[model samples]
Target chain A: MRLPKLFKRKASGEVAKDRLKILLISDRVNCSPEMLDLIKQDIARVISRYMMIDTENMEIQISKTGGYGIGSKNPSLYANIPILDLHKSS
Target chain B: MGEVIVITSGKGGVGKTTTTANVGTGLAAAGKKVVLIDTDIGLRNLDVVMGLENRIVYNLVDVVEGGCRVKQALIRDKRYPGLYLLPSAQTRDKSAVNESQMRKLVDQLREQFDYILLDCPAGIEQGFKNAIAGADRAIVVTTPEVSAIRDADRIIGLLEANSFQQIDLCINRMRYDMVKRGDMMTVEDVVDILSVNLLGVIPDDESVVVSTNQGEPLVGNHTLAGRAYRNVCMRLMGQDVPYMDLERSLSFWTRVTGIFHKSQEGRA
Candidate 1:
């Protein structure tokens, strides 16, 4: 039973962690992964009307942030939209 | 004054009531005046779990609604001298009692008992709100499942938002054999995800069912789960008790191999 590190077995820790991270985000936003994808699509479409954005590289997540000057915190939606180009006509 | 602690789990059937009953009985066994309040209301089961269902003459709603005195509603445990039970009314619903009334009742009981353990109902609803309203501390119970952990996280957030201090976690129904086999979530995995002070891990034991049927908390019982609950009670009493060595049966080589394999899989 004494095996070396070269032949390690897969434990459930990583699986639990990965699932919890994504699930906690979705739970905070009250949205499923598919719903989040749709929301991201909608955001990208709406923003692309004014600017050329890279939807593939866009990142949307829920993060826990501290309330301003207070000892409390809240979950806020953070969206990182990469702008490839802006509309010159406007 | 006694400390009021609420045992809560957003997901149902995660051993909240069991924890409340056991912890209360454990504290009482330690000679501390303890009262377990079942706040589940219409869905009350703490009475049955504690085997004090037949002795329930007055309930929590009766005290809150001015139908009876708090002492009249309190049921003393037959086994534990200092233990008591404030059963919830099965006829009434959660809406029957509000936050302020619960606070007042708990405040009165605080002057009398050494610990008031509130057995919270499942879900983040009115019942949950009322259960936590009177608590000075919180014990969020959850199983190793993803859904249960997520709910526990949400409940922790709610507790923090409501200014609850000293929040702790208890992983219930933990299978030590599965953990040793690396199939189930380990205690470290849960602690890392939830990021709360670990209370205790109750190993899955068959004696729990029998003890529940017998209407007694597992303090004096020689079951694995009973010992775990006793450890939790000691820790709650501010003792520097080390966690039970659940991996005593596992060989060193097996653990090392399991970790090595887990890390290899992670990289892959």
Candidate 2:
């Protein structure tokens, strides 16, 4: 178990890099983790008027995509909202 | 015409002032007329680092407020013939001077000096704004730690927002031993993460602290960090100097022993 644990552990440098990547993505979009929750709630309320969404399992994040460099990357909002049912318009 | 370059980092204690002093001294040693400005008001230490703290009769506030001429406020460095320092007012706050005043001062200095290095105060506050107001370029300094890198990213974003086109990065106090041991980040790791053009990397050396304490700049010394600062100054002048081989500082026996230790750890 100890040997397996050692293999599973990551170097501290790699950990710092991964952490900064995520932190910087959020920072660039100017959206905090708390703000992300508020956005999710607002989106859920609006989407629920036409279709039911699984708010409990919804995941929303602001990340950069399509570029490898710093200034070249573009910030994009990603949402994974599961649909429960589509309401028929009367 | 002289170039106004602001050395800034969002987080404090990342060696902005030291880099400013060393680079300014190096430029002066290279026969360029250089002036170092300490923009960190109410907590000024560039004078102390440059060993001119006792000679500051006029400061940035005095120059901007019409109390003294720009030449009167400039303190000539003791060692270098062409190096000078325009220190901040320790009694005043950042609000003592505005953006336009800083711009006007830099314009006046541009007619006389070859390089005007602004040692910016930490944080994205009014002091930071005043420091970059009249600058034509920027050098964002950072360390290997996560917090410093995060703040540096923020600083780069701010510089870009302010329409700064020629922004560079300088990694300071890097511990190659820790990096070899997988405990610290490498220069490549930092450059890849920040994605900025690298200026130079200063290795962590004890001589830096000693020089800072003695109120002397390190560019005149033979230390590793001193040589790194000289390389940074050369690059600032558009010289295509290659980076110093940090790993080559170690002996061949040390490298061989390091590999053996790593293999032993792998076996464990």
Candidate 3:
């Protein structure tokens, strides 16, 4: 919901929300968004060499995975790339 | 058994020390024997905030190093019968006291007082780690500003990772005027973001500055901030106290809008 603009400037609340979104995400991953994007691009590039993949529909995320041992729950990079026609493009 | 609570914020200048002083004093005033521990080490100020700075013959480092007994280091507050201060050593850094020493100190304090309040240092460093090491619960203090809230979120995560169960939030230095104008985050907005149990909200009051400067906790005074701290103390003791009426500072336009809506509802 938008409030009536009492003053002629962007609301501080809105500005805060925008900054917090990016900051919290980066803080969790311990990396910048640009770095995350670069990682995703590199993953896509490596996988496309051996398979005809639908890059537009691919999803890649780096997050902590659950495991049941000492220091076992390491961060894992998961990529779900749809193979449109595997080994057909090469 | 006594309870130990750590008051911490990831960012500095957010009034963790003030909250500790007021709440410790308020709890003591309610007849609960309480000891306030300053674990900020080199940056210790809870003693100054409680106005017990001059009484520090021994500090946390002394107790940890076996230089003095814990009782010897505890400076009793003459104003409140049950209140005491375990001031941190201004000469020592955060490295002087480790997590185990903090736990040992808190365990000893628990054997005496009914409440042990640890005033944590800012930042997610060794001091913060040591403060939460001995805490059974935590109070995350944050102002209504973005930087404070962001840091509070990080502190909450760290507390949870350390297996802290009861982490309550206190929104400090909130300006009702700014919230009404939609220029600042409201209490609800903060609660929604942090997703924690609300302990209390301390309105921005100039009396807080005067009280702090005078080395007096503002819990027992008739001022708005004092009343807020009193309510917080009651809430800590399992009492369901209603929040103070911050709406009294609402703008005229908001009241007018409310009246128009109410009139339309009556007609319908």
Candidate 4:
């Protein structure tokens, strides 16, 4: 007997975009959720290190992306870093 | 001393037993004295998967409970010279053994085998805890699905909490055709989400079902996914083999373009 086709339907042009943001709590220092937050925060912190502060209205966010491996050119990370300084002494 | 590696995942049916059987057979075929310990008590499938269920005279719990020595409980795999299996007790509860008890059991076996692969049970409960207690390292298995990844992430968190020195990931049952069609997540997505060293990726194949039904691992025979598992064993042995292309088929456009270019060259 012939096996029925597996995933033989017509392919579409649209692709799913996975939007994943893992929150970083101080105590949760490991796992995927923590790692995504670390990647985002490090980018924001790197930018903040070289610039002046406007902490009151500062916000940063990163959605998990998978088009490229973490070690290579991650244009998304570079694009998503918050441009404003996010540190304050208050 | 022989090393102990636990094949564990936080979710069920994510290919933990499959990994254990294949890795055990692969290592054994490579001339290492390998023993697979099925620690999934009350849900024993490793013996069945390995086709050693009918030959079981003693089990893991029996050794732990002092009913028999570890040697007496180990069943040798006939296909490979050095492969053995310490089957789990299907009738026992996970709570019957504690973490330290498992640690002692694996430690004793460590002196006798080149690699001891533990087939951990599902869930982050007593079975999971007991399975990891005796192992030196861990191999976390996950499917490309979100639920399996969520569970694997939790398992990785637990292992890190316990200070496991080495932990790796294996994304199994991956269907690259689905991934190309955007129907399933790619291995890259899984690696990015987990952020762990990838041991390897096993393509989803009907051969796996056939082999499991036959009570034999794909790695013990010739199959595409079986070769992937064989590569994984090599990687585990510190060989730097490149990962194979997970895509089952190039998009039709890609093949069409290749043919189009070739015919143009022929015209020239």
lDDT of 3 by residue, B1-268 (tens): 7999999999999999999999999999889999999998998899888888888899999999999898899899979889999999988899998999889889988988999999999999999999999899999999988889889978987887787878899999989887776678889878766778899999898989999899989785656677788889999999999987777834576457546654654311
Docking class of 2: acceptable
Better of 2 and 4 by lDDT: 2
lDDT of 3 at A44: 80
Q: Docking category for candidate 3?
A: acceptable
Candidate 2 lands at a TM-score of: 0.84
Q: Write the per-residue lDDT of candidate 2 for residues A1-90, one digit (tens) a residue.
A: 546755878878888988988889888888788888899999989988888779899988887665443457567888999998877354
Residue lDDT tens for model 3, A67-90: 422233245777888999877653
Once model 4 is optimally superposed onto the true structure by TM-score, how far is the C-alpha of residue B17 displaced, in angstroms? Answer: 0.3
TM-score of chain A for the candidates in order shown: 0.63, 0.71, 0.60, 0.30
Overall local distance difference test of candidate 2: 0.89
TM-score of each: 0.80, 0.84, 0.80, 0.75
The CA-based lDDT of model 4 is what? 0.77
Q: Where does candidate 1 clash, by residue pair?
A: A8-B260, A8-B261, A9-B261, A9-B262
Native-structure RMSD, model 3: 7.9
In order, the Cα lDDT scores of the candidates are 0.84, 0.89, 0.84, 0.77
Off by over 4 Å in 1: A1-13, A29-60, A63-90, B249-268
Candidate structures ordered by TM-score, highest first: 2, 3, 1, 4
Model 4, span B3-104: residue lDDT tens: 999999999999999999998888887789999999988889999899988999988889999999988999988688789999999898898788999999
Q: What's the interface RMS deviation of candidate 2? A: 2.1
